[model samples]
Target: MVHIQHKVKAFIKLGSFLKEYCEYSKKPIDLVGINGSNLAQFHEKVTLATHKNGWFSQENINFSLLQWSELLTENNLDEWLGNYNLAANNYKTVAIIMAGNIPLVGFHDFLSVILTGNSALIKQSSNDDVLLPFLADYLIQSDPSFKDNILFTEGKLENYDAVIATGSNNTARYFEHYLGKKPNIIRKNRNSIAVLTGNESTDELHALGEDIFQYYGLGCRSVSKIFVPVGYNFDTFFKAIYSYHPIIHRNKYANNYDYNKAVYLMSEFKIFDNEFLILKEDEGYASPIATLFYEFYSDKTALLEKLKQDEEKLQCVVSDWPEMKTVAFGSTQKPSLADYADGLDTVDFLLKT
Candidate 1:
């Protein structure tokens, strides 16, 4: 634990250093690209939402960055930082297959493999190639020792003690069949869900929209579908979420909304929403492209049963409804350091291997 403390301090200090450069001096750090493409993408989303979706408020960027700083300081660094003495000395390499839906989605995996004292063999997602290598370069500057451990390439998987892979549902079977023989954690496409009772406050509904709209709704953590009581007032819900109007206005996003809306309209399907776009559903998960949303329910009992049946497809559930353990609403995009993938801590995984 003493070693962990020192490493944590180092990480906090490094993060503070980077923050100072970005927030105050405007000094650009070539690596990490936190202020480069990553921040650019986020800014682009906000701009698009303002112009297209009619949602203009910058709700949580500062708060999220503060939380990120906190995560750097408070999370156990030995668990994530290279602790050569603690490693079993058996595993020499850690192969990571990363996801790219949200901005910097693969960062945690990159951190896990490198910080746990193993060589990283990364298969960068085409969507996320810019950020991870940028981070690798940043970390290398922070500690020259890290240079040897981080690697980027494209090819077949090599001999490694453990592996972590994330993919869509159709590809999960292949990941399991091919990589399961080795010690691995293979992730499949899973959607975040929401459970709504008729009794939620307007504030709660507004916050839920943040989860759905943040990151332009591209994250696995984004609430793709909603579950609400049958008699809930559509007017009340729409009014509560109108603050997110900027999201529907961005060029790319507006195009998506327009395209998806046209498709649904041409099909002669009934739609819901004030003016933006929301779609009602009969059954099944996932929303359509045009600023779409869904809701369904017979009763709590049936809802739980249905959710149980599709447990494997679920990434996380955000709900104010009864019976949820870790449901979070507005803060969906802001995952803390402790939220482990597959409920497995990377440090513990590395130690075991």
Candidate 2:
């Protein structure tokens, strides 16, 4: 078995390589630990990924890389892993069914499985197939022992000890029917929200825009809805998010915006439009792209209670509300390693399995 320190060292090297790659535009390429040929191949794959999925923009891919680069430090990994007992008598094969909503969405699962000395059988979404495999190759190069630990397959999944699947509410049912008997972590549809108290600074609201528009609002952590106080003015919110106007120029996002806006208009539902984003008074959490759903709350205490009752539907709550747990403005997309999806401890689950 590969020792845990070896695994940690390999990931730290991967983090250094990613830092250099993401900042290559600003500095000369220093291929000391990284293979130059592999870097070129990875660059080609980034281009291919963009061609295959319009939503996987180069900027977003780089952002994801940068985030992981910062996160994979030895201190961060040690701190996160120290919380649990990682020693295992016999490592199991953990199957990971990844989602393609945003770049590297399933990487945390892969990392957890590998770090715990378990083999990972990854079934990637076609939308995000190219990047993780390339990264896995890098990991193998950093530590050849990983060669036997990572596997990606398109065929039927068999002989896996545990499963971690991510999908929509519909696919989640299918996953349960098929993989529920195994030790599994099956995730369904969940959305994030922001609570506005009508006293936020201009900077705070602008940062909130980052929480909304990053990844084009496709990520589960992206804030899709907001809770505003009764009689709240929306003009400030619009002006704060105006900096994200360039997002509409992306063809796919623009198409979604135009289509949804037309449907609302034809149906004669009242909406607040700013030529780029629409604000609708919706009670639901999942808002369509280019639109933000909102609701008015009369009392903070009652709103907190309602949110508590619907916690299962929420992945994040962006707010400064002292009465509840909340994520800081603009930091939803940059989650720490310990921020498990659906608030379930993946590493703990894998270790126990």
Candidate 3:
């Protein structure tokens, strides 16, 4: 088995390559010791990814790359892995069934599997099939040992010891039925919510817009619903998010906006519209694209209690409320390595398996 430090070093090198690639536009002449041909190949792959999935816009893909580049630092990796013992007498093959909702959505699971000295058998969602294999190639180039550790399959997954599968509530049931016999993490649907007090500054609300609109609101961490005080004026909130108006120009997003708006209007549901976004009083957590669901709360205690009761359905809570755990405004997508999805510790799970 490859040593844990060797695996960490390979990831750090990959991070360095990603950092340079994200900044490549600023320094066109300097390859910065990165393989020039490989850099070109990665750019081509990014273009191919966009062509394959309209939702994977160039800007969103770059944002994901920059985030990973920043996160894969030695300090961050060390701090995240320090809590667990990584030594193993034998390595296991872990199967990862990925989701394609956003770019690199399954990367954290893949990373956890590799870092724990296990082989990864990845079955990628067809919507996001281009990028991760290219990244795995980069890791293998950095250290040839990774070539044996990573495998991608288009057929049925077999010969794996454990599984980590992510999907919608329906698909999750399917996954549990087929893969549940193994040690597994079957993740289902989860959405994020924001709590807004009337006193939020324009800047805070503006930041919240990032949490809502980034990744075109496709990520599980994206805030799909908001809780506000009764009779809260929304003028400030509207103005703060007005900067994201250009998002409506994207054809796919515009199509969703127009379609959902028509359906809402035909159904005689009262909705607040600004031509680009529709705000409806919805108790549901998962809002359709280009729409935001909202509810009014009268008592903070009761709201917290309700939220606590529904914790399993939530991926994040964007708020500054001191009584409960909260993610800062606009920072839901920028989770740390330790921020496990569904509040389940992946590394710990893998270590035990």
How high is the CA lDDT of each candidate model? 0.65, 0.92, 0.92
Report model 3's TM-score to 2 decimal places. 0.97
Q: Could you give candidate 2's per-residue lDDT for residues 47-134 as a string of tens digits?
A: 8999999999988899899999999999999999989888753589999999999998999999999999899999999999999999
lDDT string for model 1 (55-83, tens) is 22333333333445556654455343444
Model 1: residues with Cα > 4 Å off, grouped in runs: 1-10, 21-67, 74-89
- What's the TM for model 1? 0.81
Better of 1 and 2 by lDDT: 2
Better of 1 and 2 by TM-score: 2
